[model samples]
Target: MTAIKPGLKLKSAVCSAEVMVIKAPAGASLTCGGAPMIGAKDDAPAGAALDPQAAGGCQVGKRYVNAEQSLEVLCTKAGEGSLAADGTALELKEAKKLPSSD
Candidate 1:
């Protein structure tokens, strides 16, 4: 687990998913595809495999957030991985309703 802060780009260890920290509390464990994420620039070891249980697909440009909303991440690259924080799956944030121009 590492300290999560805004503007930190993270890459999934098991997949090609990439995300940027939008808002995160200290000491948040960010994971993707059931594997811990690393710094974007960090090289992923060869032959890494994704966890079968966590193989949910990630969408590009989606904002995934935890239940408490204390942690939020913006997906930059798409891949077969679900975003999670502290072992809890992140849900997509609902879009704001637009005003009706009657």
Candidate 2:
């Protein structure tokens, strides 16, 4: 996989999920719906099929990140697929807690 960089947009080859790179480490493999994500301007493979095991369903307007904090993606469209990096699933970024006024 090519080195992913911030501001790069990607689209799922198997589903409608779309994402923009927030932060990505060099040499990381980004995937959506169990298939390699392509450039945002590129079209999905005509006969591609979704992998059942990777169908965790992504949420629109959500941010996903890996445990290592080396990769981050912001979903632009929702789809029946989960985000991953090098075969490991990414988790939704937790919401930040608000500071107390007291």
Kindly list the per-residue Cα lDDT of model 1 for residues 1-102, writing each as its tens digit. 457899999999998899999999888989888888998888777777798888887899999999999999999999898888899999998878799989
Off by over 4 Å in 2: 97-102
On residues 1-102, what C-alpha lDDT tens digit does candidate 2 reach at each position? 446899988889999899999999878888888899998778777888789999998999899999987889999999898889999999999878789989
Model 2 local distance difference test score: 0.89
**What would the TM-scores of all predictions be?**
0.88, 0.89
Model 2 poorest ten-residue lDDT run: 1-10
